[model samples]
Target: MKHIWPIAVMALALAACEAPPSQEDAPFEPQYLGIETRLLEGDLVNFHVEMRGARKTRDIEDYARCAAAQYALIRGYGFAQHVRTQVEQREGLWMADAAYLISDALPKGVTNIDAEVTVAACRETNIPTV
Candidate 1:
């Protein structure tokens, strides 16, 4: 009986100490910020691939995750992930925006796109619709 009471109390104490999931615990959601026709950085990447983690900026551990997000951005654009990309930063709901800059000339299908491409998870960019 004494041992049972101690075990029960220990279990209750451990359960009380368990932390709830934070924004950092959230999964990665794909995001993109549509820039003006002129902002695609030339032909290859017309849309700035902006990604934010479910966690806030303070939770960002390193540039590698940002880099992966950049690659994912290019992949999100229906382009090959062969090219190099750089990650930039901005504020976000839980995490900061990671901007992947594609430095090469975009392929023909990518250049001069008239409409914005969207995915299920991306937060919409505020480009005025004509």
Candidate 2:
């Protein structure tokens, strides 16, 4: 019984050291690279979003879209219309350069995003928005 107690203690110590992966070490999710914004005109802004480990252009584009939506909210707009998005991969990281127009009314045919809702969605999906 004495020998068994020492073995159990060592086992418990090792188990404590082998902690599970934290949120920072999410293997299956794309990590945020960066976000940049430039005001082009009144209610129009250029957004750039880059993400590492994004397997597809859609992933990086979504990040950009999320950024744009959140930015519109920050700028006191209610809706964001996607003007254009250019996606590229460099050095194994995906980057999306996008343009958005913020407006009070939703545009026709374009994928319009509600500023508040999109920001919340980004947070829930682990996408960074600014």
Candidate 3:
């Protein structure tokens, strides 16, 4: 019947217009380039991290955080307070410049991170540290 043919065509058109599957299902393959550490002041330190295949800016930020945690531990510090993190992406390469205050006692901030705990987490998550 004419009505059945029209319905079938409309269904076919609708199916063709359906959106493609989401890219979130793709495997995350991130390559961490390296990290540069600088002593900004007495307790303040800066970390510059670079990576590729980052899913978002948070990935680069996390990389910097991991570096800061490990760096603090290396310096015999027990805690680090996050100051700021700047992230940029260029041509599939992501970079973050992060600052943290390394301290023996817990810093007075909401962003304070336990170096030992953070380093352990980073290792468990397969993220490299400085």
On TM-score, the leading prediction is: 3
- lDDT score, residue 13, model 3? 100
lDDT of each residue in 37-90, candidate 1, tens digit only? 222444233222333552443223122233333343444443222233344455
Stretches off by above 4 angstroms in model 1 are 22-42, 49-130
- Give candidate 3's root-mean-square deviation (CA, Å): 1.8
Candidate 2 or 1, higher lDDT = 2
What is the lDDT for 58 in model 1?
28
Model 3 has an lDDT value of: 0.92
Which structure among the candidates has the greatest lDDT?
Answer: 3
Report the Cα RMSD per candidate: 9.2, 7.8, 1.8
- Better-scoring candidate (TM-score), 1 or 3: 3
If both were scored by TM-score, which would come out higher, candidate 2 or candidate 3? 3
What number of backbone clashes does candidate 3 have, counting pairs of residues 3 or more apart or in separate chains? Answer: 0
List per-prediction Cα lDDT, in the order shown.
Answer: 0.36, 0.85, 0.92
Using alpha carbons, what is the TM-score of model 3?
0.89
Predicted candidate 2 versus true structure: per-residue lDDT over 1-130, tens digit per residue: 7699999999999999997976346666667979999999888899888788876677888899889988888877889998899998888788888999898878786578888898898899888889
Residue-wise lDDT of candidate 3 within 34-60, one digit each (tens)?
Answer: 999999999999999999988878888
* Candidate 1 minimal-lDDT segment of 10 residues: 112-121
